[model samples]
Target chain A: MTQFIQQLINGLSIGSVYALIALGYTMVYGIIKLINFAHGDIFMFGAYVGMVAITTFKLNFFAALIVAMAVTALFGVIIERVAYKPLRKSSKTAALITAIGVSFLIQNGTQLIMGANIYAFPQIIANQYFDVYGVRINLLQLVIFFTSIILMFILQFIVKKTKLGRAMRSVAVDKDASVLMGVNVDNTITITFAIGSALAAAAGIMVGLYYIKIYPFMGFAPGLKAFVAAVFGGIGIIPGAMIGGFAIGLIETLVAGYGSTLYKDAVVYGILILILIVKPSGLLGKNVKEKV
Target chain B: MKNLLNKKNLVSLVLLVIIFFVFDYLIKARILTPYYRTVLYWMGIYIILSLGLNIIIGITGQLSLGHAGFMSIGAYSAAVVLASNPTITGLFIGMGVGIVLTMIVSFIVAMPTLRLKGDYLAIATLGVGEIIRIVILNMTITNGASGISNIKMLMSWPLLFGFVVLTIFLTNNFKQSAIGRACIAIKEDEIAAEAMGINTTKYKVMAFMFGAVLASVAGSLFATTYYVVKPETFGVNTSINILIIVVFGGMGSLSGSIISTIFIGFVNMALQPYAEMRLISYALVLIIVMIFRPQGLMGAKEVALNVLPDFKSFFRKKEKSS
Candidate 1:
């Protein structure tokens, strides 16, 4: 049905955003083995920065996007250096708690500065739609889909072909071994954060453009859902994150479109529990037996 | 009886009685301001919650981020009881209901989660917690998000202070028990513990259930005393806030939890003027503590009176032959 196609479009648009965020989560988790809970906040930060770019400096939409991505990448590097780097040698609990702390700080700190009201994201790209055989599609949705796909391909290329990518992979496999091989584990981790954050920043800008709104608390739900996606596709796996992101997005969109909206969140969280229970290693993750 | 009548036990008991009366006098004589009483109330409540949480996180090394979900369940059930019968007897009934319900729900939750390790378990707990919150948000008894209100207050000073002592005693006793030691072994290494003939999952569930029991009692008190119960009261933010306190204080140290609670409670009270910064400050504290002192302020050291030098030892140092 046309209705199904229409819902699919909507789903892919949002799914692209989830995929972008999930990629970031997967990359950081792959490199550092930390969840990087603050990644969502970095996405939010990107949106805010983009807002400032347009409103204060009167930059064009593309320029603003670039600025957001660049600034957010730098921001991610800083967070890793300050909040997470010290605890790298410490317990996972400490790292996790610190990640949560950084998340809360960014959220509440933004609230204090921005106030609680929802702000309209700058609308530079005029909203337009096309109708074909009763299946109408928003131009922005297509834009989001293609742009994210291109970005994802670019990320894949970087990971597969670049020297830094090789270093990142080696570091992920064995930090001590990689260090002995002269990988510079710390810089590799920092670069991974930067790339992941930049991708999430792109997702942020697109989400704001798609929704036409941005709020300080907007990041939490998507952050969680993206985390689920990363886990679903098998965390620390790039391609898996992509597939998982689209699946969750489609599922969520379909649920909201057909079922009661209130249950949407419950359904998402339910999937999280189910996936974790069924496959703690995730869909694409290989089971590694624990050794004493 | 003989063990109960030991000198240390008697001294602690007498001290508790004396401290209770001192606070009782302050409340009865109206010497303590309402502001101070309110602060003490929250501090006591947080202490109770932290103690329960510590058993799972600190002592057992289980990461349970959904503790607030457990609190919400007990809180709402107890609130319903008090709404109908506003009496001391009702309070006990409410607490009993809370304990029973919390035990069942936590057991079911722990079944799947406890099998996993660290982050997976944390997310699963968070998922379950969020699911519980969302479920209550839609239920008829919960009255949705607006939640239940207009309950008669039953939180007397005696009951509040007594419950605090009871929770501490319970956690301390649990920590010293054989099962508690097994839980610790599991935390230290799950594989090794299982190899040592310990049923890892069973002991984990026991520790989790015991924690829920305490949280539920605290929740019952929260519903009765706070005179309100809403879904928002037990959200992820609230869980993180309580967790920050537990981690800030030493995880395995009861004295650290109590001391850290008092310290953070004072900091929050002082920040009443800047309400916006209050949450931000809590976030900063967690970050700072985790980064600078991941072992927590108290670590595993239980700072108690046993460490205190005797009065005679301070004055009679000359009796020692060199």
Candidate 2:
């Protein structure tokens, strides 16, 4: 039972990180209808950026987090403007292929620059633990959980209350109509990318902090699982992403704990295939019939 | 036989025969070098894989990313068979086993997975690929993670390219048939095809199973060539590499797939010294090409094979048309 609680906390920490990244995937997908395959790579890029901020720039943990977010946010905007924006009018497959290219570029380029070997994520946050009711919880887990909740709250507030959020929602619903309504559709899209990227950065940095090991390839597995989470929750639905992320995290941790970790990836992929078949609309998405 | 002897096809067939003989002679003479010969062999294998993938992704409009799973199925089955028999005849039997197993697996996979669309389909297939790799990783018969490397070594240039030819012939004929047209309609617009009574699911399953079996055939060749079968070799990267070839050449164009495979194969060979840049360049090429020309170099266009004697007239006609 103690082990169960311990695992649950760990799952929550990781789940929020997945949720953060899933938000980026969900938002970009919501607006552009492209999967933005580079998102996981972007998350990895953000982690590396945060690592640099602490190791090279000598920034505090919070400061590094902010720096990573800012840098990655700008990077995301540039990617949107250069890679995805031009292909917007073209086929979604083209856009998807380009997104994959960007993903490879970032993942491989990071390997080139950072080397393929895994490195100790600088202990910006010391590994300290606290126990409650015979269950141990770590400081980083608390940070990840609270920080994710706060960030999500802020995101919710922005989308619900802010004008940019309104523009984002409008763009998502009907881009042409939004344009007719005098919304700066391009600007909204860019900002949406920026916001999503920034959130990804936060997730990336927190992940680095929690795992204490950062590598170029670290993003691929979680990226995929988080994508499953997004799809599981109902793609393009923000809160659905959150729920899906937690569910995937819990399932993954439970499987690793009870079952052979060798089949961890297989189980996730199975769920992806199963959920996609059984509930294509996901736990939260509305079923939109295929149009003629 | 008469249809096979049509002017355009006769010219292409004669050209194929000449090229095969020339390469065969070069292999015998050791002129092309073993390294280049191996390159050509791999290229042929890649050609088969990409042609199959093109049938699924380009022609049939299903975004399948689990082809490597099928390829792995072929490769491991063949390797296991060869390990036991260790004869040319056994190798053939292994290939047969591969195709049968691939057919069964793909049929089961396609039945339910084909119902999804677009990105959902892509993710599901990717998941399926990962699952297959993981399953192989844990299986005892596959030697777990160490893989099955003790194959008897009975591979030949004729056998390899023969499969490539078969793949091309099948894909080409399939595309020329009513089934291929139905796939194209689905690619163009699935709902419209369904409205027209095209039995979208059945056609998709047919295309998927066919494409997967071709990959399985290529897989047998791949295992025989490498003399080793590891789960990692048939990972998502391999699947994506095949897709890259299909897209770079031109989706829905067999000739384009061939051209792109050769081009990318040679480029990879040239860039072997700079191993780091090979994938980086591929990524750049995909991004740049997608931005500039999403239809690819051929853009659903084929290289028209005029009779060899008409080379002069071909140029003259081009000049006149211009």
Candidate 3:
């Protein structure tokens, strides 16, 4: 029972990180209808940026987090403007291919610059453990959980209460109508990318701290799994992404705990297939028939 | 009958024969280094794989990211068969096994997932590919990451060249066939095709299975050439590489696929000196190509022999018939 609780706690921490990344996927997909395959690589970049801030710039943990998020947010906007905006009028397949190209570019570009070596992240947060009901919980896990929740709350408030959020929602629903309403569709879309990328940056730093190691290609697997989470919870749905992220993280952790670690990836992919088969719209996604 | 007996057909036939003989002589004379020969063999394999992928992604209009899974199945099945009996008959039997297995697997994968459209299908196929890789990584028969090594090297230059030719011939004929036309119709408009009484599901599955079969054949050849089959070799990277070839060549153009496969294959070999920048350059090429000319070089056109037009008009002064 204690072990179960321990695993659950670990799952929550990891799952929250996934939620942060999944939000980026869901939001960008909601607006642009492009998967933004480079989103994961953006998360990777965020970690590297945070690492550089702390190790090179000698910034403290909180300062580095803000720096990383700002840098990544700008990078995300650049990617959308340069790579995706021009292809918007092209075929969906073209946009998808370009997104994949961008993903490869970031991954390989980082590999070229960083030399594909794993870097040990500095311990910015002190690691301290506490026992509750004979179940051990760590301070870092608590920090991750609370920080993600706060960020999610802030995101929810922005979308629900802010004018920019209203514009984002309007654009997501009908780009043409939103344009008619003078929503500045392009600016809204760019802002969406920026917010999503900043959230992913936070996730990246949290993951780096939790795992204590960062690498160039580290984003691929986690990014893919987070995508699965976004789909699982219902793509383009904010709360759905949160739910899906946690569910996937828990499922992955439990599988690794009980089953063979080698099959963890297989199990996650299997669940993705199963979800796709059973609920193509995702768990939280509403079914909309295609119009002729 | 007239078309068959046309001067164009005869000339093309003679040209093909001469080219084959020249290649044979070069191989016999050892004028080509072993490294270059290996590159040629790999190019042939990639040509088959990319052409097959083209039938699915370009013609059939289904996005599949799990092609590497089918290729792995072929590689492993062929390697296991050849390991048991390293004979000419064994090679064919291995290829046969690979084709059958890929057919079954692709059927199962396509049936459930083909119902989804676009990005959903892409993600599902990606998941399927990852699942196949992870399963292979865990399975004992695959030797669990160490991979099947020391397998028989059964593919000769002539054999590979023949298969490449056969693959091109078959895909080209298929493209011009009724079924192929149906696939194109589906790609153009699935609903309109369905309204016209074309069985969209059946043709999509057919195109996918055909692509899978060809991929397996390529995989078998790859295993035999390298004398090893590793799960790692058939990953998302391999699938993407094949996709790049198809897109760069020009979707729905068999000639384009062949040309791009050879071109990219040689370029990859040439870039081996700067291994770190190879993938970066590959990504850049894809981006630049999509941005500049998404239609690709061929732009849905086929390269064929054309008769020379009469040049008498050039010399003659333009005089009205009246």
- Candidate 3 lDDT over A155-234, as tens digits, reads 99999999999999999999999999999998999999999999999999999999998998888888999999999998
Cα lDDT tens digits for candidate 2, A198-256: 99999999988888898987887888988999999999999999999899888888888
TM-score of each: 0.95, 0.95, 0.95
Q: Give a tens-digit lDDT track for model 2, residues B151-224.
A: 77666678876777777767877887789999999999998999999999999999999999999989988888
DockQ of each: 0.78, 0.78, 0.75
lDDT value, residue A121 of candidate 2 = 77
Candidate with more favorable, higher DockQ: 2 or 3: 2
lDDT of every model, 2 decimals:
0.86, 0.86, 0.87
Off by over 4 Å in 1: B309-322
Q: CA shift at A137, candidate 2, in angstroms?
A: 0.9
What lDDT does candidate 3 reach at residue A266?
A: 86
Residue B158 of model 1: what lDDT?
Answer: 93
Q: Model 3's CAPRI class?
A: medium
Q: What is the lDDT of residue B302 in candidate 1?
A: 71
* Deviating ranges (above 4 Å) for candidate 3: B1-9, B305-322
Count of clashes in candidate 1: 0
